[model samples]
Target chain A: MSTIEIAGKTLELDADGNLANLSDWNEDVARELAKGEGIEELTDRHWQVINYMRKVYQENGDAPSIRKLTKESGVDTKELYSLFPKGPAKKSAKIAGLPKPKGCI
Target chain B: MAEPIEKVSIVISHGSLEGVYPGLIMANGARMEGIEATVFFTFFGLDAIIDKRMDNLGVATVGNPAMRMPGGIKMPTWLGAIPGMSRFATYMMKKEMEKLDIPPVREFIEMIHDAGGEIYACKATVDMFHLSENDFCSSLDEIITVGEFYEKSAGAKIIFT
Candidate 1:
């Protein structure tokens, strides 16, 4: 476990770097996290994925997998990868302050 | 930073709905973790890449000893061979997958490709089926020989399903 300080608040992260407490998530925290992920800017497209992930997590009790993220999140698979780079689902879930997706590995 | 399992090569050899999905799901999962993924389709698994048959994959209910009914009772193989049983099983499986937001075969393959995952069909299988490249989905990267697949899979973790 570790802590990342954002906007004067410390938030917990698990060993895999996902937010330990979902309640600590906010736009500011997401922006800071995104920057660390090589995204200097969080465009509307980035927010589209982030918000969609958070919404789905709230409804489903887990982050959407990459398949669902691409098909139902209003972001195509190509765009999602470009926006989040490397691993879209894991990165977006980290930025959205959600747990590591259930079956990401 | 050290490269985390740089690539994963998966082989899908069965055409049944159950047989095909594990490879797809694992490949997709690999991409989600930033690992490069490649899926090699051969034998009956070729159905998963065929343009017309990919989306219509059916469950192999007959002779599957592990299949069970909704209440967890073992599904007798005799019952599985009844007409329309395969279709019913397929529908039930699709519904379960849908409830979990798992995509259909076509969309799943597209998602893997769009995410930079490589998809391949076995050349011999293509020849056996008399399938042209056009018979496969556009996302297929190529139809290559087994030797060629092994060459490309060098240094990667290979999963046979």
Candidate 2:
């Protein structure tokens, strides 16, 4: 476990560097995490995926896989990779304040 | 930390349903992990890229000792030789994979292609099988010679399945 300051709040990060507490997530924290992931600018498209991932986690207790995200999140695979860059499944989940997805897609 | 895999080149050498899925799954998994993937379909594995037969791929129930009944019960080898056994086995496997959200071969190929993974057919195999470029799915990037395959594999880990 490690802690980092985001938007003036000290937040604990899990082993994968996701927010340890989903309740700790906010728009500001997301921007900070996005920057850390090299997404210097989080556009509306990025927020669309981030919100969808967070919603899926809230209902299913886990983030959606890349396939699921592409199939249902209104974003396709190429765009997902472009939006999140390397490792869309893991990187998006981390930015969405969710655990790393477990299974291979 | 382990060094990340930047690129992977997979060679699929067999044509059976079991033969093809490993290469497809691995290539797709590599792209999901942000690694660049190139799939080379060669020899009998060309069946996977051929539009006419790709969707109908079946496990060879006969001679496959690992074959099992629907509920994991061991099946007698002789039963696998029945005319429809291969098709039946393929149907069952597809249903099970669907429950896990894995797509069919056609969709899987499209997914990998749409995600920017490269798919190619082997030139030697294509000629031997009497297949033209038109015989393959649109997702096939090109029909490449072995030398071209090696060129793409340069600096990348090569996996043969």
Q: Best-fitting candidate, measured by TM-score? A: 2
Instruction: For candidate 2, write residues B1-161 as lDDT tens digits.
Output: 99878999999999998999999999989988888999999999999889999998998898878889988898888999988998899998888888777888888999898888999999998888788988999999999999999999898899999
Q: lDDT per model, in order?
A: 0.90, 0.88
DockQ leader: 2
Per-residue alpha-carbon lDDT of candidate 2 for residues A1-105, written as tens digits (9 for 90 to 100) = 799898777999888778899899888888889899899999899899999998988898878766788899998988988898777888888888788888667
TM-score for all models, in order of appearance: 0.91, 0.96
lDDT tens readout by residue for model 1, B76-99: 999999999999989999998987
| Candidate 1: Cα lDDT at B99 | 78
Docking quality level of the chain pair in candidate 2: medium
Which regions of candidate 2 are displaced past 4 Å? none
TM-score of chain B of each: 0.96, 0.96
Model 1 steric clash pairs: none
Candidate 2 chain A weakest lDDT stretch, 10 residues: A60-69
Native contact recovery (fnat) for each candidate is 0.69, 0.63
Q: What is the lDDT of residue A92 in candidate 2?
A: 86
User: Which TM-score value belongs to model 1?
Assistant: 0.91
